[model samples]
Target: MRIVVLAGGIGGARFLRGLKQAAPDAEITVVGNTGDDIHLFGLKVCPDLDTVMYTLGGGIDEEKGWGRTGETWSVKEELAAYGVGPDWFGLGDRDFATHIVRTQMLAAGYPLSAVTEALCARWRPGVRLIPMSDDRVETHVLIDSPDGSGRKAVHFQEYWVRHRASMPAHAVLPVGADRAAPAPGVLEAIGAADVVLFPPSNPVVSIGTILAVPGIREAIADAAVPVVGLSPVVGGAPVRGMADKVLAAVGVESTAAAVARHYGSGLLDGWLVDTADAASAAEVEEAGIRCRAVPLMMTDTDATARMAQEALDLAEEVRA
Candidate 1:
């Protein structure tokens, strides 16, 4: 089977690991969200892409579900001692090497897609991971400035990593997605896929931002395969992160049914919600999406794989 997955950060990375276990023989292509990419200290950082790669390659910090395993913080400590910092965003010594190599390759004029491929050669993440767009598409959040000043736009990293999404966001926009084209294999993978899935990643800034790219959303909608999604919101709250804050920014309620509707029946053929949200299944189906209530938590690889299997089963049902 050929499957395409649109993924972002920790939730997405962990889901991909489960998907791999569920379909070991399947050819998986992950279209990673580059909207989370940021340049820090003159080095480019692709957080979502690295998370997926690291998780799949068995290099992920199991406890944190992101970053390198057994990571050290010497470089971060040294930078702090210099008193030059946005110390809130933690990038450890081991993680710095990734940024350094990525920045160096980018400076040599290799597009991000090529650089990612080179890096993955070492990790052998098992799936073909492609950025949503090779062009920069930094997500920014509009929020009130500190000291009760007027509203201002901040990088998504600042709003997410620094403030921890504490402030009310007026809007979330992907700065350069308007002109960005899909990375080399993104469209092709979607076109050739047997199934496509949106994992339980943050809807607004993760999957939503990847869909913001010019052609990706259209490609998935028009593809012959069944496009399914697992709701990130269970009952009335996110499984992880501050997805509710960002979801509110887009005027979507933090509920399984609401999120399924947010994606819409036109794009999504099937939707999965947690058993905790079984009551919302009918509402999702009424909106023209095939809905099922299943266990959606990623408590462990085994549990997560069951969720993946449920998603694939729903896709096949839709296809039938």
Candidate 2:
């Protein structure tokens, strides 16, 4: 089987791990969200792409869910000691090397997709991983300052990593999505896939940002395979991350049914919610999506593989 997965950081990476185990023979292609990419300290950082690569390649810090396991912060600390700080955004010494190499490759006229492939050569992250777009598409959140500093937009990282999404987000926009084209193989993977999946990543910023890239949503909708998704929200809350905040910004409630409706039936053929949210299945199905409720937690690799298997099962059901 050929599977194309639209992914973000941590959650997406973990899901891919289980998908690999669940369907050991399947060919997997990951289209990672680059909207989370940022330029910091004169280096380019592709957080989501790196996360997926590291996690799949056995270089990831399993407990923390991001970054290298045996990481040092000498670079970050040196920068802070010089009072050159955005200390709130943690960048470790080991992780910094990735940004440096990516920035250097980009400066040498390589597109991000090519740079990603080159970097993956070292990590050898089992699947074919590609960026959603070769162009920049940073996600920014519109929020009002709590201390009467008035309304302003901040990078999505600031809203999430810095403030922890505590402030109300009035809007979330992808800064360069207007003219962004799908990275070379993204549309081709979806079109040639037996199944497409939306992992339990942050729906609004992760999956939504990928879809915002021109031609991606259209490609998924027109693909001849089953396109399925697992709910990030389980029992009225996100399994991880502050997805509810961005979902609110987009005017969607953070529930299994609401998330399924947000994606809508046009692009999604199957939707999986946690067993705790089983009551929502009918409402989701009523909205024209085939809904199934199952154990959705990823407490371990076994648990996550079960979730992936369920999604594939749902895809087969949709295909029938």
Candidate 3:
């Protein structure tokens, strides 16, 4: 099968691993979200891309879910001693090597898509991972502080890592999205896909960011295959990450049915909700998309693979 998956960071990476286990022979192409990319210490840091690559490439810190395995904090400590901060986002020494290479390639006039391919050359992440867009598209969060002043826009990472999503967000903006074109292979992958799966990733920032790129959503809508989505909301809350906070920013409800409707039947052909939300299946189906209730928890590889199978099964059902 030619499967195209829209991915975010840690959760997307884990789901991809399970998808591989579920269908080892299938061809998978991942369109990774690049809205979290930031320039730090003169190096280009693509957090979401690196997270997926390292997690699948077997160099990831499984416990932390981000950064490299067997990581050391000497570089972080030294930087801190020099009063060079933004210490909230931990960039390990080993992970720094990746940013260095990526930055060098980008500076040498290689597009981000090409630089990502060059980086993946060493990691061999198994699937072809492409950025959502070659053009810069950064996700920013608009939030009001404790003083109740006007809303101010902050980088997604700053809202996520530094503030921990504690503040109420007024809006979520994908800066530069209006002009950002999908990366070279992104639309083609979706256009030629046998199945398009939306992993149980943060809908607003992860999958939503990918869709923000021009032509990506249109490609999926125009694809001849089924487009299926797994709810990140298992039981009224996200499996991981503060997805609810961001979802609220866009006036979307946090329920499984509401999230499915947020993506809408126009874009999605099938929706997978947790067994706990079986009651909501009918509502989703009523929205013009086929819905299935299954165990959507990623407890381990086996459980995640089961979820992947369920999604594929639903895709087949919708196609039939």
Candidate 4:
């Protein structure tokens, strides 16, 4: 089967591992969100894409679910020693090599899509991981600073790593989204997919950012295949990450049903909610999409595989 999955960071990467286990022979294409990409120290760091690559390639810190395994921080420490700081975002020594290669290739005039392909050649993530767009589409969060100087926008990483999503966000902006074209294979992957899934990622900033790229949302909406999404919310809280805080920025309630409604039946054909939110299944179904209540926790590989299977099963049910 050909599966195309729209993904974010840690949560999406872990789920992709389970999806691989569930269907080892399946051809998987991951449309990774790049709105979290940041230019630091003259190198571009794509947090979400690198998260997926490292996690799947077995180079990832399984405990942190981001960055490299057996990592070191000499570079960061040295920079801090020099007072060159923004020390909030952690970048390990091993992970720095990735950004180095990516920056080098990009400086040589390669688009991000090509650079990603070259990078993946080394990792062999066992899936085709494509950025949502070659053009820059940075996600910025509008928040009030400590000085109460009214609302100001900061890079997504600053809001996430520094502030830890502590403040209320007035809006999440995907700068350059209006002019950004879908990366070369994104639309094609969606069109040719047997099943398309939105992993239980940060919907507003991750998957939402991917959709914000021109032509992506339209392609998914028009695709003939089933587009299923697993809810990141379980009992009104995110499985991991402060998704509720960002969701509030978009005026969307952090409920399974609300998330389903936010994606809407127009683009999503199926939705999966945790068994804990089974009561909301009826409302989700009434939204003109197939709904299922399943155990959606990713506590371990086995649990995540079951969740992946449930998403695929729901897709098949909806398609039938």
TM-score per prediction, in order, is: 0.99, 0.99, 0.98, 0.99
Model 1 TM-score (2 dp): 0.99
- Over 112-191, each residue of candidate 1 has an lDDT whose tens digit, in order, gives 99999999998999999999999999999999989788999999999999999999999998999999999999999999
- The clash tally of candidate 3 reads 0
> Which clashing pairs does model 1 show?
none
Off by over 4 Å in 1: none
Candidate 3, 148-225: lDDT as tens digits: 687789999999999999988889999998899999999888888999999999999999999988889999998889
Tens digit per residue, CA lDDT, model 2, 1-320: 99999999999999999999999999999999999898899899888999999999999999999999899999988998999968888889999999999999999999999999999999998899999999999999999977788889999999999999998999999999989999999999998999999999998999999999989999999998999999999989999999999999999999999999999999999999999999999999999999999999999889999999999999999999
- List of clashing residue pairs for candidate 4: none
Clashes of each: 0, 0, 0, 0
lDDT of 4 by residue, 165-237 (tens): 9999999999999999999999998989999999999999999999999899999999998999999999999
Whole-model Cα lDDT per candidate?
A: 0.94, 0.95, 0.93, 0.95
Candidate of highest lDDT? 2
Off by over 4 Å in 4: none
In candidate 2, how many Å is residue 107 off? 0.6
lDDT (Cα, 0-100) at 37 in candidate 1: 91
